[model samples]
Target: MQRYRMALALLGLAWAAGMAHAASEMPVPSALVGAWTLERVDNVYPDGRRVELYGPHPQGLWIIDAQGRYMMQMVRAQRSGFAAGDKSKGTPEEYRAASLDSNAHFGRISADDHTMHTHIEQASFPNWNGKDGNSAYTLKGDELSYVVAKPSSGASEGAHGEVVWRRLP
Candidate 1:
């Protein structure tokens, strides 16, 4: 009876070990390459305002290469141009208006199983330069959504900012 029980226990342990190995051998999905559009952004502010930062419809695109480089730009569709026609001559109000309504960053990204981090070499907003932004991402068919650990809203979620991107057809 002791021998029989030992054999069964060893079999169970072997099976569990094999299962773990198979899980680890599974290939990481190939959905991160290519172009994606910023379909929508939801900012769950701690102040109880679930505001749509941009209007109902926003415009943005991101193109990432297999080489790890990526560039993204998004803005309120109709941004007011610097009235002086020379960018250096823009007024403070015009500059502020443009700054508040747009986001653009270009850099390289490092990703693992469920996480990706961006090292912003340069950004439209200078404050982001040299910053590291980490995000948790999920890909389902043509849509990829990322929940980032940033702009802490001090809410239940801790990080209440989520941005969704659709793989461009």
Candidate 2:
């Protein structure tokens, strides 16, 4: 029994170590060469209604290093302060609020100048774990904008969301 417990513990440690290494190693795509700041994200419906996905002045940043690893984060504007001054001391409501207001993910990417494919290794949103997806993008000067090549479940036919980004120098 003691031997089995020791084996399990070592396996757990090995898995954690593997995850840490994978997080830092990735091949970055050339078209997404720089850091990009989120300008806005909007969901347009077939009925012509436009909805802001993260409130006005939504905050986000995406960075793709030369190695192909990337980290992306987004949050609603003006998130509430955790009253306790300690992140772990926040109330359940505070925790829920924070999760609902933001998202983050990290992974590897492959792209040409027009299309990007992501292999998500980790994500704050659990449902996206181990998922792979792609987007179509366009770059004009300092701006880089992209849209999901396929309609999301919330989108009606012929409707999609657009995420605009500004290239960082």
lDDT of 2 by residue, 52-103 (tens): 7678899999998777778999889988989999999999999988887787
Roughly what TM-score does model 1 have, to 2 decimal places?
0.73
lDDT, candidate 1, at 75: 72
lDDT of each: 0.76, 0.80
Model 1, residue 59: C-alpha shift (Å): 0.9
The candidate scoring highest on TM-score is 1
Per-residue alpha-carbon lDDT of model 1 for 31-66, expressed as tens digits? Answer: 688899888876766565665555567789998887
lDDT score of residue 160 within candidate 2: 84
- lDDT score, candidate 2, position 1: 100
Report the error of model 1 at residue 53, Å: 2.2
